[model samples]
Target: MGAVDRYLQEQHIDRYAFLPFSACRILQPHKLRNCGEVKTVLLLLTPYYDGDAADRNLSLYAVPRDYHLFFRELFAGLREAFALDHPGASFHAFADSSPIDEVDAAAKAGLGLFGDNRMLIEERYGPFVFIGEVLTDADIPCESGEVRECEHCGRCACSHEVCLSSLTQKKGELSGEEKAALRNHPLVWGCDDCLLACPHAKNVEKTPIPFFKTDKQYRLTHEMLENMDEEAFSSRAYSWRKRETVLRNLSLHGE
Candidate 1:
């Protein structure tokens, strides 16, 4: 284990991988300079609280308080630590909205199993994990770990065409076929058919992060949305789309 690994362990973060910063694929050319001075990328698997067995409509990812906020809070300490150690080194922390392709980067770093549902599934946390990164100028070597592939059992229950998540997040009115699908779909925000159907979702451990464990919230009601302020909206994963987008999906199902 290296200093980077020690940092992860000290932070109680067990699921992490390191790769060269140059290996990142989705970052735009202009933004590449943000990481140009960085030699190593630290990929982190941060877990959120999936709700209890309530058959709730919200996606598992949204069960916790805004993860982007939580991740920034979580990684802030690491950034400071790295800066102290490297003296003038730069570090940036990103959750979902960063330009980097987190999933592909995690796969390249041999972090977890790639599922047909297009999620990264780790042994302890399953696939219900958020991928984040800390790009730094430190010369941390990539973890010499094995990357796992999905079983390819062809058991995936959802497709891009019928994926409720994609259709709901899409701007403008829903297509006729999409509206028809929404009418029967169980969740108002995200689709979990593929997640629930995966054998990997079974028998996973609860998240150790205090933010996820102590501050779990499952449902997202119309009342909640009506009361949500800008700060609240800007924190969660679904905030990229406007409030109207969520309301449109909710109204389609009469929720």
Candidate 2:
């Protein structure tokens, strides 16, 4: 095992893969400013599902605090360790705001199969894991794998325009038809309709990470939204749209 693998194991992060930069599809080259000549991509999977996430007004992923914050702290430590190991090597970490197509990279690395819903589905964590990566100039050994596809159950397929999760984050006023769709939508932040219909997502193991297990807000009520300040809103996954978006969703649902 390499230093990176040892560090990940110590951190209890078991799902990870190493691939050559040539295999990755760089979507945002502008994001890689100082990271010169990336030679390797280290893809990681951080599972957040804790089990039985029912009766939540937010998506299972959003029930916990914003994962971006978690990744920031995690990557800081990782980068520091890498810097110490290989002097002059550049290491950059990214989560949702990634330079490469993370899902595609993860699939190519053999971390999981591409689900029909366009999510990476690990056998244990299913599609509930967050994809993060560490891009480096160090020449790491690449894993031998290929892009694999899921069973394609065809249950989670839906148009992007009509997706309740997408509509909730959409800015400005919604159309009458869109309003009707969200009237009885379970979550005010993100939709789990697709995950709920996925067979592979059934009875998955709970996350061992304590950060996700504690300080969770499964149900964000109208009262909570009304009382939320900037600090509280910014700390959550659904905070990107601000409190107004959630409040509007709740009101439309007559909650």
Model 1 per-residue lDDT tens digits across residues 223-249? 788789998777766777889988887
lDDT against the true structure, per candidate, is 0.75, 0.85
Best by TM-score: 2
Task: Write the residue-wise lDDT of candidate 2 on 1-255 in tens digits.
Answer: 656666777767899988888888889989988778899888999999986555778889998899998898888878877777677887888899888999999999999998888899998988999999988898877864788998876888874457788888987788898888788677788888788789988888888887788889888888888788888889999888877787888888776
The 10 consecutive residues of candidate 2 with the worst lDDT sum are 1-10
Q: How many pairs of residues collide in each model? A: 0, 0
User: Model 1 compared with the native: what TM-score?
Assistant: 0.86
**Model 1 pairs whose backbones collide:** none
| Model 1 segments more than 4 A misplaced | 1-11, 22-27, 143-146, 157-160
**Model 2 Cα shift for residue 186 (angstroms):** 1.5
Indicate the worst ten consecutive residues by lDDT in candidate 1. Answer: 140-149
Q: What value does the lDDT take at residue 236 in candidate 2?
A: 95
Give the top-scoring candidate (lDDT).
2
